[model samples]
Target chain A: MKNYFSSQFKLGILGGGQLGKMMLYDTRKYDIQTYVLDPSNEAPSKVACNHFTQGSLMDYETVLNFGRKVDVLTFEIESVNIDALETLEKEGIKVYPQPSVLRNIQDKGVQKDFYKKHNIPTASYEKYAFAKAVKESPQWLDNLPFIWKSCTGGYDGKGVSVVRTASDLDTLPEVPCIAEKMIPFKNELAVIVARNVSGEVKTYPVVEMEFHPEANQVEYVICPARIDETVAQKARDIAEKVSNAFGHVGLLAVEMFQTENDEILVNEVAPRPHNSGHYSIEGSFTNQFEQHLRAILDLPLGNTDSKVASVMVNLVGDEGYTGPVKYENIEHIMGMDGVTPHIYGKKETRPFRKMGHVTIVDHNIEKARTVAEKVKGSIKVIAQ
Target chain B: MKNYFSSQFKLGILGGGQLGKMMLYDTRKYDIQTYVLDPSNEAPSKVACNHFTQGSLMDYETVLNFGRKVDVLTFEIESVNIDALETLEKEGIKVYPQPSVLRNIQDKGVQKDFYKKHNIPTASYEKYAFAKAVKESPQWLDNLPFIWKSCTGGYDGKGVSVVRTASDLDTLPEVPCIAEKMIPFKNELAVIVARNVSGEVKTYPVVEMEFHPEANQVEYVICPARIDETVAQKARDIAEKVSNAFGHVGLLAVEMFQTENDEILVNEVAPRPHNSGHYSIEGSFTNQFEQHLRAILDLPLGNTDSKVASVMVNLVGDEGYTGPVKYENIEHIMGMDGVTPHIYGKKETRPFRKMGHVTIVDHNIEKARTVAEKVKGSIKVIAQ
Candidate 1:
C-alpha cells in the first residue's frame, strides 16, 4: 500500500457544490490531499479543501490542466467535461465511478437504453433527436400526457415539463430529449449503494420521498420508507444489481417509483452520492461521505444500518427573497427534538437557491416525520 | 452583523492538529474562512482548511506574521506565542480565549495559583524554580510521595515524574516545576464548557476517563460519567467557575480527578476542543466541534444534552510497531452494533501514537462501555 497521507499524492475533484463540500469532510478526516475546481468564487467547498481553483468545470483545457496534477480524479456533478477526464485517464490518472458511468448518466436517453440493455426494470421511454422531430410524427399525440425531459442539463424541475397538450410543447426547448410514459405510483423511494474497487458492496435502507402538493418538489425524505419487508429487500437487490452492472467504485443512488400495481420502476440513477442519502449522516452506522471515501480507495465497505429512523427537509431560499440570507426562526426549530440543521455556507441567497437542510432522527419514524414537518414549516431561508 | 460568509473575513488558527481538523468540520459547515499555521507539514488540519501556512506556533515573528492575515485567531494547543496574540489584540485582531487565559493555563504552576485565587478546588502543590532549588529546600521533601510535573509542556505522561524517593530526583528535569500531593482517585472526569463573546454559556455532561494501568494513559472516555448525582453537580459547578474566572470565548475542557472520598479536584484545562469531548460527535444534541464554532463566531450557544450514552476508545499504535500502519481487524469491529471508527489518516505507525478512535453509543451506557472494551481489545494499529 502506498503511504499517501501527508505525501505528494493529490485527489482532484470537479464541481465544488454542497456534495463536494460534504465529500471534503471525509477527505479531511483521513488527511487526504484534495484540490477542487469550481466556477463560483463562493462555492461551499472553497473553505474546506487543500486548494480551490476558480475555473469552469466543463472547460476542456481547465479540467485537463487540473487533472494532471492529481493522482485520482473524481466529480460531484455529472455535467463535467468527459473529454478532459478521458485525456487524464489516458495519462494514467484514475477516475472513479469511471467516465463511462458519467457518460451513461449525462444523457437520460442513453441511460434508459443502458438500463434496457442490462435488463434493469425502468419506465418505458422513447428518445427523439429534437422536439420538432417528435411533433412531425402524426401519431405523436397518442403518447400525450407523457413526461418530456431534455436529454441533457435538466435539474430541479428545470429542463423538464409535462406535455398535456400541443401548447405544452411550445414551452419545451427545441433540443434532443426523451418522452417517457408517466407511471402512476403510490410513493417515490430511493436506495443508495456503495461499491469499492475491490468489489465490496453495501446498500442503505430504502427511503420514502414526500413531495410538495403544488410545486411537485420533494418536501421531505423519510428513511425506512413505510413499506413491506419484501419490497425493501427487492429495492436493495435491484440497487445492488445496478451498482454491479456499472462496476461503480463509489456511491450509486438509485431512485424509483412504487407503482399502484405493486411494481418498481427505475426513475433514474446518479453515479455519485445523491441528495437522498443526506439522512445517513445522522442516522447511519457509516455516513455516505465516508463511504464514498472507502469505495473510491477500495477499502472494505462499512455497515449501512440505520441507528434511528430519520427524515430530511431541504432548506431552499424562500420565493421573492434574495441578498444576505437569514435562516428565520432557526433557533425555534433547533429547540425541537432530533433536529440538526446543516447550513451550506452560501452567503447571498436567491429565490429557490439551496441554502441548507435539516435532519430529524428518532426512535420512531412517525415521530421523526412529524418533527420534519414542523421544521419545514417553522424555518425559512430568506433574505435579510 | 458582518457577513463573513464568502467575504473578506478571515479566522486564524494556531497549532493545527486533530482537534483543529475536527473544528474545521464546523467552520466548513458555516462556510467561515480560516487560515491555519502549524510547524509540521503532516498536520491533520492542513488539508481541510482554507489556508495552510507552515510555521512555528510558538515563535513570535512567525505567529505574529500569521496572525496579521486573519480577522480572528484561536488555537488547538496551548503552547502558542501569547505575546504575539497580545500584540495582535492591540492591533485589533480578535483572539478567542484571550492571551491572558493562555498565559495562566499554559503553565501548571500558574494554573494552580489561578485556581487558588478564585477559590476553586484543586490538588495542593508547591512550585520550585528548578530541581536544584527543590533539593536545596529540605522542607519541600515533606511531600515526598508526590507527582513532579514540569511547569510547561507536559502532555500524555511525558515530562511527568512520580517521585517516591530522593533517587527519583535524578530522572527529573532540571527546570522550574511543581510537586503536587497525589490523590488516590476512584475515577477521572472531564467537563467541556463553551462560552461566547456575549457571555452565553453551556456545559456538556461530565465524562469519565478510564486509564491504562501500565501506560498511565487514558484508554476509554465514557460520556455521562456514571457518578452520584451530587458529585456530577459539584463537578459542573467547579467547571462553570473555572470558565467564568478565565473569561474565555470558545471551548474550555477541564480535566479532573474524583477522589475515593467523592471529592473533585481540578487537574488541568485545555482552552480549545479536547480529546475528552470526541464522543460528542456521535452522542450529543450539539457536538463540541460546532459549539466551538458558535462560540468564536459569537453565535448563540447550543444545547449540551446527550442524545445517547457514548464510549470512545482511542486507537493508538501497538508497542514495537513502526512503519506503514494497518488497522488489523478493523472490519470485524465495524460489524458490531453502534461502532463507528474514525481513522486520523496518519499513514505511519509509531508505538503509542494516536491513529484514530472508535465511538460506541447506546441507550444503555453499560452496554456501550462493554462494546467499547471489546473494540479496544479487537482492533490493532500495527505496521503493515
Candidate 2:
C-alpha cells in the first residue's frame, strides 16, 4: 500500500465548501497534504488545507492547472469541469468518482437517459430547450401537475416548480429544462451509498426527509426512517444498485420518493458528501466526509452502522433577516444533551440561506427527534 | 452568552501542538475565528486556524503582542510565559486557568507545597537547589530510589530521572529539582476535571495509563479504568478538589497513583488537555478538546459520560528511526472496527517521539482492549 500519511502525498479537493471542511477533519488526522480550490477566497475550507487556491471549478484551464499539482483529485461539488478531470486522468493522476460519471449526471437530460438505460427506477421526464416548448407539448399538458426543473444550475428549489397549469409554465425561466410527471409520493427518503475505487460498497440506513410545509425545504432528516423494515431494505438495495451502475468512487447520496403504495423511485443523486448525511458526523461509526475520503483513497470501508439513532435539523437564515448571522439561543439548545450545531462559516444571514446544521443523536430515535424539534424551535439564525 | 461564531470574536491559543489542532475541530464547527502562535511555522495547528503567528510562547512580549489581538486567550502547553498570561488577564483578555494557577503549579516544589497546604494527599518529597546538593544531603542520600524531577521546565519524562545511586545523579543537569519517595502503586490513573468560568465542574471517568516497561512512556490509555466503583468515585472527588483548589477555568488533568490499599495520591497536574484524556475523543459523549473549548468559553460543559469504552495507544516513533514518518500498515488497522488514528502532523520522526495515537472503542472494555492490542501490534511508526 502507498504511504499517504505524513508523506508528500497530495490530495486535491475541487470545492471548498463545508463538505470539504468536514473532510479535512479526517485528512488532518492522517496528516495528509491537501490542496483545495474554490471560487471564493472566503470558502470554509480555506484554513484547514495545506494550500488554498481561489479559482472557478468550471473553468477548464483553472481546474487543469490545479489538478496538475496534486496526486489524487476529488471534488466536493459535481459542477466542476469534467474535461479537466479527463485530462488529469489521462495524465495518470487519479480522479475519484471518475469524470465520466460526473459528465453523465451533469445534465438532467443525459442523467435521465442514463437512468432509463440502466433500468433504474425514476419518474418519466420530458426534456425541453425552453419553458414555452415544454408548455407547447400536448402530451405534457395531458399529464398535468408535472414538476418543471431547470436542466442545469438548479439547487434547493431555486430552479424547480410544481406546475399545475399552462400559466405556471408561462412564468418559468427560459432555460434548458425537464418536465417530469409529478408523483403524489407518501414520503421523500434518502440513502447514502459509499463506493470505493476497489468497488467495495456500503450504504447508510435510509433517512426520512421532513420538509417545510410552505417552503418545501428539508427541515429535519431522521435516520432509520420510520418506515417498514422491508421498505428500508428496498431503499438501500436500490441505492446500492444506483451506485453500482454509476460506478462512482466516493459517496453517492441517492434521493428517492417513496410512493403511497411503497414503491421507491429515484429523484436524483449527488456524487459527493450531501446534506442528508450530516447526522453521520455524530451518529454513525464513520461520517460521510470521512467515508468519502476512505472510498476515494480505496481504503477499507468503515462500518456504516449507526452507533446511535440520530436526527439532523438544518439552520437556515430566518426570514426577513439578512446581514451578519447570529445564532440566537444557540447556548440554550447546546445545553441539551447530544445537540451539536455546525455553523458553516458563512458570515451573513439571508432568508432561506444555508447557514449550518444541527445533529441530535440518541439511543432512541423518538427522543432524538423530540430534541431536534426543540433545537429547531429554540435557535433563530438572525442578523445581529 | 457572547456570540463568538462568525464574527470579529477571536480566540488566541498560545501553543500549536496536536491539542490545539484537535480543539480547532470544535472551533471550526462553530466557525469561531482563532489565532494560534507557535515558535515553529511547521506546528500541527498552523493549517487549521484563521491566523498563524510565529513567536515564542515563553517570550513575554511575543505572547502579549499575540494576546492583544484576541478576545480570549488560552494555551495547549503549560510551559508558556506566565507573566505574559498575567498581563493579558489584567488587560481583560479572559485567559483561562488564570496565570496565578500556572504560577502556583509552575514549580514542582511550589506545587507540592500547595498540595500539602490544601491538605491534599501526596507522597513525601524534598526539594533541592541542584542535583549535587540533592546527592550531598545526608537525609536525601539515605533515601535511595527516590524520583528526581527538575523543579521547573520538566516535560514528557525528559527532565526527570530515577535516582538510585550517586552515579545516576552525575549525568543530571545542575538545576533546581525535587526528590520524592517512590511509592509502589497498583495503577497510575488520571481524571480530567473541566471547570467553566461560571464555576461549573465535571470530571471524566478515570483512565489507567499503561507505560512501556523500558521507556517509561505511556503506551496505552484505558478509560473507565478497571477499578472498584468506590475507588473510581474517590479518584473523581479528589480531581474535583484539585480543580476547585486551583480555581482552574478549563481542563485540569490530575494524574494520581493508586496505592495497594486503594489510597489515591496526587502525582501532578496539567492545566490543559492531557494525554490520558485522549481516549475521550472516541469514547466520551463529548471529546476532551471540545470540552476544553466549551469550558474556556464559559459555555455549558458537555456530558463527560462514556458513550463507549475506549483505549488510546500512542504512536511514538520506533527506536533507531529518525526521518520522515510513516505509519506502516495503517490501512490494515483502519480495517478494524472502531479504530481511529490521529496523526500529529509532525513530518519528522525520532525514537520515542509522539507522532500520533490510535483509539480503539467498543461497547465493552475488554473487547476494546483486545482490539487495542491488535491495533498496537499491527501498526508501526517508522522512518521512510
Candidate 3:
C-alpha cells in the first residue's frame, strides 16, 4: 500500500553482515531504498545499500537515531539493542520479527523455557546460574557427556561444548549455562518458516545438514531432506507450530534433530535467514531472502517449491591460512555444470572463517549431492 | 587468475542504467570492486557500485579518466565514446567486447556492411547521406513501404520510421540514414552468445519477441521460442557465427527475423546484455549478467541451458499520466505463482517509459506464458 518501490520510502537495517548483504540484493531488485548500520566500515553490505553508517548495533542511542530515519526497521542479526527496538515500536516505527520474539530467543535458557512453555518438543535440559553451580551439583555430574551451552553471548560454535568428562568442566566459561541431555540423533534437519504481518505463513522443505566427521562443522545442506514422507511432514508441522507460537514476522529458521526413532526435537531457531536455507537461492522458486522481504513488507508470499534439487557447501578458510583470502580452483569448479559460488567479500581468511558458499543444482538430488562434494573438494579458501 | 574476487582488481563500467545495476549484483556477489560512470547522479547503479563518477560517457576525456581508474573496463550501453575505449585498450586496460566490435555495431550502416562482407543473410538496404537523398533517388520511390533508420545515435525506438508514403519522408530527420527493404516475417527472435577472452564460446537458447497487436511494442519475450528444434538450432548456429566473426569477448545478442519460409536473417546485434535475454534471470542455469561477467573476466562460463520455461513482460509507464511513478497492483501480481517483479528504481513515470520488468517462470512453457499474460494485464505503471 505504501509506495515502497522506487519511491521515498526508506528501510533501515541493523547489522551489515553477509545476511544483510544478501538481503540488499532483493531490496535492489524491488528498487527499495535501504540504510544499513554496522560497526565495521568494510562491512560486506556497505556498498550495496543506499546509505551505510559506521556504528554499533548494540548502542541504544545509535540504533534509536537510525530507526527514526526510516519508515520500517529490521535487523539481520539478533545482537541488536532490544531496548531501542522497543522504544522505536512505541514511537510507531515498524520493526519486524518484533522485539519480544527476539528477547525470548536471545538467551538460551529463556529460549528453552519458551519452548517448554509452548509445548514444543525439545531436548530435556537443566538450567544453572553459573558453570560453577553445574560442576558442584551431583545431578549434572551424573549426566556425563551432556551438552553445555552458555545462556547468552554465544555464536558460531562459541560458548558451546560437549562435556565428555569432568575435565571438560574446567574449560567451561564462568557464565550462566544450560546442561542439555545429548540424545543420539540420526540426522540434523532444519525448516525455514515465513510469517507475514497479516498472519499468512509458509514453510520451506526440510533440509538435512551433513556435518564434517572430524571438524563437527556442517559440510553440506541438502533440501527435501532424504527421509520418509511422514517424517518430513512431521518436521514441517513442528516448524509451523514453532512459528505460530512465536507469532514473529519475517523468517524463522527452525533447526531440529531427527532421532533414531524418527521423533523430531527442536534444536534451536534463528529469527532470520539461516545457512540451512541458502540452497533456496538457486533451487527454490522463491529464495529465503526475497521471501523474508515479502513477509516483512506484508506482500503475498511467493512459491516455496523447488525448481531443482540443490546442495550448498560452505567455503571456509583452510587451516594454517590466515591472511588475504584467495579462492583456488574456483574457476575449475565453476566450469562444472550448475555450480554457483557466492563469495562474501570478507578479504581476509582466518582458519575456518566463512568466506563464501557454493550451490550445486541438478534435476536429480543424488547428482546434485555428488557435484556438491566435487565442489567442496575442488575449491579451497586459502591465504594469498 | 588475477585475483579478481575480493581483491585489488577494479572493474569500470560506462552507462550506469538497469543493465549495469543488474551486473553490479554479480560483482557484489564476488566482492569485486567496481567504478561506474554515468551522466545522471540518480543512475540506478550509483548506489550498488563501489565508486560513482558523474560524467558524460560520450566525452572522450571523461571516459578515458574513468577507464584509467579501473583494471578492466566495459560498458552497459554501446553509445559510449569508441575513441576513449581504443585509447584505454592501447594503454593496456582490458576492455571486453573490444572497441573494434563496438565500432562495427554502433552505426547501423556499418553493421549492415559487416554482415554483407561476411556473407551473412540480411535484408537488402541502401545507404543515403540524408533524407533528401533518399527521397530524390528513384529506386527508393519504388519501395514505398520500406523502413527508415538513422545511421547512428538511434535508441529506444527513436530515429526509426516506416515510410508508407512519399509524404512520410517529410517527417524524417535529415541525417545519414538507410532505407531497408522490409521483409515479410513470421517471427522476431534472438540468441545471446557469450565468448570469453580465451575464445571459449556458448549460446543461450533462442527467445521469441511477441509484439503488441496494436501498439507494435514488444509485449513478451518467450524463452525456447515455441519453435521447431531445427529452427532453434539454426538460429543458435547463426548467432555463433556472428560471435566468431566479431571475435567478441563478452555477450553479443543477435536479433534475427524468421521469414515465412523458415529462413533466418540477421536483423541487428547488441554488444552487451539485451532485453531479449531478461528471462534468463529466472529461467536459465546462468543469467545474462553473470555470463557477461564470466566472459569479460575470462573466467569459465557457466551452463547456458534453461532450468525452466520463462517469459518476461516489460513494465512501461501508462500514457495518461506523467510525473512521480507508482506501481499499481504490483502486490497483486506478486501473489501469482512464480512471478518476480524487478523495479528499475526510476522515481518518475512518463508515457511509454520503461520502468521495470516482470519475469514469470514455470515448468510448462504454455503455463508460463499464461501467467505472463495475467501479470501483464494485472500490473500498471503510472504516475501518482
Worst 10 residues of 3 chain B by lDDT: B210-219
Cα-based lDDT for every prediction: 0.85, 0.90, 0.92
In model 3, state the lDDT of residue B266. Answer: 97
**C-alpha TM-scores of all predictions:** 0.88, 0.97, 0.98
Q: Mind giving the per-residue lDDT tens digits that candidate 3 earns over A142-241?
A: 9788899999898767778889888787788888999999989999999999999998899999999998765566789998799999999999999999
- Best-to-worst ranking by DockQ: 3, 2, 1
Clashing pairs in 3: none
Docking class of 2: medium
Output the TM-score of candidate 3.
Answer: 0.98
Better of 1 and 3 by DockQ: 3
- Give every prediction's interface RMSD: 3.7, 1.0, 0.8
DockQ in order? 0.33, 0.73, 0.84
List model 2 lDDT by residue over B257-352, tens digit each.
Answer: 999999999999999998998888767778888889889998888888887788999999999999988899999998999888889999899999
Question: Which sections of candidate 2 miss by over 4 Å?
Answer: A136-140, B135-143
lDDT of residue B273 for candidate 1: 89
